[model samples]
Target: MTTDPQTLTWFKSSYSGNGGSCVEWAPMQATVTGIVPVRDSKAPNGPVLSVPSRSFAEFIAGVKGGAFSAT
Candidate 1:
């Protein structure tokens, strides 16, 4: 389930350029609820995907560790 984006502060990696292919997350809410809110940077008002904190963290770690291949 998703929540009102207006009530949350969203952010993406600063290292990520403004290529419009980035993902934004609401860290504030995650700290309180242990659920991560993810949304497309290209569509702020679009649907938000809520993921469990542990799962989200593992996914991020996988990304950083290059566990996924772009191809």
Candidate 2:
């Protein structure tokens, strides 16, 4: 499935703070669909990752839970 590219309002994670990690996502878009689109904040026209709604939720949970830094 696809969406109107011009209408997407993407925002970077609040956790990103002042760093240049540059990750962006459209939460409003995900609310309208069952998928979440994520991409580089610096590359609006670049590749995007479309993840299922549930998976996106889990990803956020993991981030909040600090799963990525436990390795």
Candidate 3:
């Protein structure tokens, strides 16, 4: 099934405490499609990244697990 990129809904994470370095994702779109559409919150008109649902999930898990270092 094909989905319209323009119709996708987007939202930022609660953990993204008003930081300039925040990204938004279309969870509703991901539910309808297997791909998660992500984009920089600071630049909504900028390029978007479509990641696979499973991969996005893993990335989120890694973030929560602190697998990535701020430094």
Tens digit of per-residue lDDT, candidate 1, span 13-61: 8877978899999998999889999999999989899999999999989
Clashes of 2: 0
TM-score quality measure for candidate 1: 0.90
The TM-score values for the models, in the order shown, are: 0.90, 0.83, 0.86
Candidate 1 residue pairs in backbone clash: none
Against the true structure, whose lDDT is highest? 1
Model 3, 1-71: lDDT tens per residue? 26554677779888888668899999988887788999998888778899999999999999889999999
lDDT of 2 by residue, 37-56 (tens): 88887778887888998999
Task: Please give the lDDT score for candidate 2.
Answer: 0.83
The candidate that wins on TM-score is 1
lDDT of 3 at 44: 81
| CA shift of 18, model 3, Å | 2.4
For model 1, state the Cα shift of residue 18 in Å: 1.5
